[model samples]
Target chain A: MAHDAAAGAQPDPSSGGWSREVDLPSERGASRLVMEELLEQLGHHGWEPTDIFGIHLAVEEAIVNAIVHGNKLDPAKTVRVSCAVTPQMARIEITDAGVGFDPAAVPDCTRDERLEVPSGRGVMLMRSFMTTIAYNARGNSVLLEKQRAPHAG
Target chain B: MTAHRRIDTSKVGEVTVVRFIDKKILDEASIQELGAELFGLVEQLNRKSILLNFADVEFLSSAALGKLITLDRKVKTAKGRLKMSNIRPEILEVFQITKLNKVFDIRGDEAEAIAAFQ
Candidate 1:
């Protein structure tokens, strides 16, 4: 299917850099590709390998959350991803269509008892990798940013 | 997004071998289904030793890790063991990032993992 380049669409211009929008099915597997594209774009802008991995992980976690939980994996629905790269950082936004969820409602997975339970660590991992993460007004959209590491050659 | 993939299960003697033939596992439903499958295998075999082979898997997210952790806990409660083998380099990096490599009994191959139980 043709990628939906419209949902949560926005232009991201940073210090004369380029941005692109990707529309993907709200299913599994798509997130990995999306993350790869993000990495490629960031690399084109001179991001280092370590920063590339960090950005890829953060984007994957955010987009996966949107596709699985927000859009419920409905093929009919699409998760929108837009990436903006700047000399200072890379910012990405992913939006889904399902009823919004409160991030505060998610349990802390780092606790001793919950540590071994499978799942609910995506957001935590994103926070750990990215410099900042914020929920849009609707709560179905997430904005993630990772500051370019020092020596991003 | 949470990638979807299937887990193919087979038996080798008293051991239940759960093979992850997909490249990645990221979706919520798939994670839950995987968890259910592992639980069912443990109950059906009444065996605590499981060998999760990830030879085909290239990536794994925290959600996927969660499923493995859940299975680990279930097997431990049943007095069984959970061992993983043939993890790809990229996926192994994920396990290390989460420090799961330290907690999980990871081996180089299925024979070594299964032999550990014997």
Candidate 2:
């Protein structure tokens, strides 16, 4: 499914920085479509395929963590996704209503003992793919940024 | 060739090849469901060795990777080996970042992966 960024998107200044909010129910598969649409938006903004895939894949992990781990798949709790797509960079912020945790406490998936654990890799991925990943003091909100190469966004 | 739900499967000698039809696997429920499907197939078919071909898959999320780990663990418990093949570099980066490359036996081609079981 192709999501046209210019179709219903608001115009912004060339310098970058226009964002839209996506409220998703705490469902297991809800993150897929949102990430797909976000990728399409970034592509429209001149992001290259490799750049798009890199960021898109990371964002997918973030949204899934927010929905599954943070919200615990509760229907009442909502995962809020904030997106900013620009030619120079893309910034996505995801926040959940559930209580947050210490990011430092996550076990290393690379370790043999923790290799089979299911929840350890998402944050690692976000931190790896995004040039910068900032979390709120409460740890419930995460801001992920990826700078596009000079050739494209 | 046999189609098993969303995943397509085929037999090459004694090895079973499971190919994912979707390019991207980011859906959490779908990933969980995939784990179940793989486990059921392994048990039903009594297949000890398997090859997971990712040639058509372009992207994957952590949840999907976790499911793969789960599937691998089950195969190990059954005294079988699960090998992955044709992982794209971009997708492989995720495995490298998570350091899951150590946990998975990733091969360059399906033939190599299939031959490993024997």
> Each candidate: what lDDT?
0.76, 0.80
Question: How does model 1 do on interface RMSD, in angstroms?
Answer: 2.9
Q: Write out fnat for all predictions, comma-separated.
A: 0.43, 0.82
Q: TM-score, each model?
A: 0.70, 0.89
Candidate 1 chain B weakest ten by summed lDDT: B1-10
Residue lDDT tens for model 2, B8-90: 88889888898986777766566766777788767777788889999989888777887888888889899988999999989
lDDT tens digits, residue span B1-118, model 1: 1232476777788787878755656555676777776677666657666899998775567877877887788888888888999986656767765667767999999998889889
Error of 1 at A142 (Å): 1.4
| Model 1 residue B51 lDDT score | 91
How do the residues A17-122 of candidate 2 rate in per-residue lDDT, one tens digit apiece? 4667777778877775466678778878887787888898778778878887899988878888878887887999999988997889887777888877866787
The ten-residue window of minimal lDDT in model 2 chain A covers: A1-10
